[model samples]
Target: MHVYADPFWLPKQGNTEEEYEDACCPRKVTERASCSFRCAVADGATETSFSGLWAGLLVQAFGSGRLTSKRRQETLRSLQGRWLSQVSAHPLPWFAEEKARCGAFSSLLGLELGEASICGGGRWWRACAVGDSCLVQMRGDAILSSFPIRDSRAFNNRPLLLSSNPGRNKEATTMWTSRGGTWESEDAFYLMTDALACWFLTEAEKGQQPWRRLRDPQTGDGTFAELIAELRRNGRMRNDDVTLLRVTVD
Candidate 1:
């Protein structure tokens, strides 16, 4: 199958791009046939400092296939030390030191696309997620499936998160979930952080077919930044760091 990945992201209002706490990996879109594709997104917990770094590390690990169910614990254990060492490598005040000691946290969602193993199977995808960052599969105009989260009402202020402090992640494995499904040509996939995921589900609940608007967020002014800004202005979406990785399989 052929695949293309397009990523769109924006910082929360009043925050600069550098301050954006969400992350995605393996950027640069190209339409070409391939045996497999890996993509993932992560949302940093805004309440913590240096969470962007943790989020970045998480997505890159998944994108690189370093983090997986079989080795999630070991990988996270290694990444925890990495995150800690990086943050403390520089000098810091006592209070700041305490913050760094507290560690950073983030939510993660990863997807892998490849040929189906079953007979007569064309294509298939498997995704694993921890927390509310979500994945949705779209077959043409309608959504085929949603993972880790399926209902708008399920979203809340507190989502299970992965933290640099391994103790905070003792239950990460339990919170983690996996889902898989088959896809046809022209199908689309969306990986979004919680804020937009909630809005997507809400719109779907209203029978609005939110995928119609998302096929290309580049409408009206020709920029995704403007689209998210408009959504925030109208109070149509919650104010938070918004990150989306869109892919089309053909």
Candidate 2:
């Protein structure tokens, strides 16, 4: 199978790119032929300290297949330790230390695509999600499925999130969900952080072809940052770190 994967992202208004608290795996555009592929997007909670780093680790683990459904709690428990080690290697101020004790949190969504020759010679995909970060599978002019959060109205400031503290993760891990489906030649999958995802779902619910907007972004000056700025200014999208990973199979 031939796959094309592209990631677009922008930091929140007033926040430099360095402060963007979101992460994506395979953080580059690529087109290639392969039997399988793994991709993931994570949105770090800005309220927590070191959330960006925790988000990065989550995506890396997901993309590398280290995080899976089997023994998921154990896998995540190990990952939480890794997050702590990285964050606590140096001393922190009293305030930062207190925040660290509460721990970082992030939303995680991971997708895996591959050939399923044994299942009647077709392509297939599976995904898992921990929060509002969403995956929408498209075929032709319609969306085949949407994961984690389907309705735009379902979104809110509070969302279940993966935590960098093991003691606080049992609920999040238990709430994680998974889905699978067969892939078609012209299928496209869009993975997005909560802000862009809510907008996408809202537009679709209105009977508008939101996928078209994403597939062919009309960025001013041909830059995603400009497009995101426009969206935030017009109230079409929320003002937050935005990320989208579009993967097409042929």
Candidate 3:
């Protein structure tokens, strides 16, 4: 399978260009001609611990590689073990002592195996979160499933992992599971950070169809460019870093 992958990382406007950074390293790990995967991680900069660092590390560990169910579990365990061990042995007293007010960042992954694709489960895949990042699935023009984001609840900052803290549980929960079957030829999948997701859907509601119209063949600008244009023109995504990963199975 040929992977049509494009990644855009930019800082919130007004800050210097250097203010934005991405640890997302997109890679094709295997030589299998029939398989391709798209993965992305966006770390939240402000957290009691480094959420972005953990998010990036977790994605890098599992996103690029192929995994059986067992290996996937092992990978999650090892990541949590290593991360917590490092933090415990050499405590960052400064980070621990101060209740630094920072929101959590999210990690999303989508792997296409022929027609069926699995989404979002590199440790804490089904876990609870405070922020409202979401995953959307589409088959042609219809919306399939959107992962629920809990914003009104008290447990907003906590992620649904095996151990809430790495030191406590080396095993992180699996977030991605198959809905059971292949995506049709016309199907497409989209996952985005909350800022971008909310804005994109809002535009779509206005009949702007940032996504629906982008599928038009005449303009030929491409999906990423069209979406970026929408974000730049509308002030919907100015408050945070805007990252979007889209998968279309033809």
Please give the RMSD to the true structure for each candidate, in Å.
2.2, 1.9, 7.0
Clash count, candidate 2: 0
- Candidate 1: misplaced stretches above 4 Å? 30-32, 116-122, 217-222
Per-model TM values vs. the true structure: 0.94, 0.94, 0.60
TM-score of 2: 0.94
Pairs that clash in candidate 2: none
lDDT per residue for candidate 1 within 1-250, as digits (tens), equals: 7888888888999999899999998655657567788889999998887999999999999988888788888999889988988998999999888887778989999999986533345688899998899899998777899998999999999988889888777575487889988888889999999999999999999989887777864532346777788889999899999988888887
- Which regions of candidate 2 deviate over 4 angstroms? 118-121, 171-173, 217-222
lDDT of 3: 0.47
**Which lDDT tens digits does candidate 2 get at residues 1-250?**
8889889888889999899999998899878788888999999998998999999999999988888787666778888989999889999999999999999999999999998663346788999999899999999888899998889999998887899987676664477899999998989999999999999999999998878877874632256776677778999998999999989998
Note the Cα lDDT for every prediction shown.
0.87, 0.89, 0.47
Worst 10 residues of 1 by lDDT: 216-225
